[model samples]
Target: MNIFPKAQFLILLSEDLFSHPQETMNKVFQFLELAAYLSEEYLP
Candidate 1:
């Protein structure tokens, strides 16, 4: 959506995992939550 493919973004995350697990996991969940929210068309 931001000129970057989600697939590529995920690959980048995987590459950084060893260096930053806590931060990456937090962000990964955030992204997952956002995806779920968007799919549900959340309004809150």
Candidate 2:
């Protein structure tokens, strides 16, 4: 699966996300090549 240089496929679990919100989000952000600008205060 070489669509692009950054192309990727990720499978996340509900239990893992609920148990480790920050870690899970970090993985998502890193995969998307995004900056972690939204802090805990910005979340609902």
Best by TM-score: 2
TM-score for each candidate, following the candidate numbering:
0.43, 0.65
RMSD to the hidden true structure, all candidates = 11.0, 3.6
lDDT at residue 11 of model 1 (Cα atoms): 40
Please write out the lDDT profile of model 2 over residues 1-44, one tens digit for every residue: 46655356777897877777788888889888998655573231
Give all candidates' CA lDDT scores. Answer: 0.53, 0.72
lDDT of 2 at 31: 80
Tens-digit lDDT track for model 1 on 1-44?
Answer: 78977665554455565576555555676766653222322222
Which one is best on lDDT? Answer: 2
Question: Which clashing pairs does model 1 show?
Answer: none
Question: What is the overall TM-score of model 1 with all chains considered together?
Answer: 0.43
Clashes of each: 0, 0
True-vs-predicted CA distance for residue 35, candidate 1, Å: 13
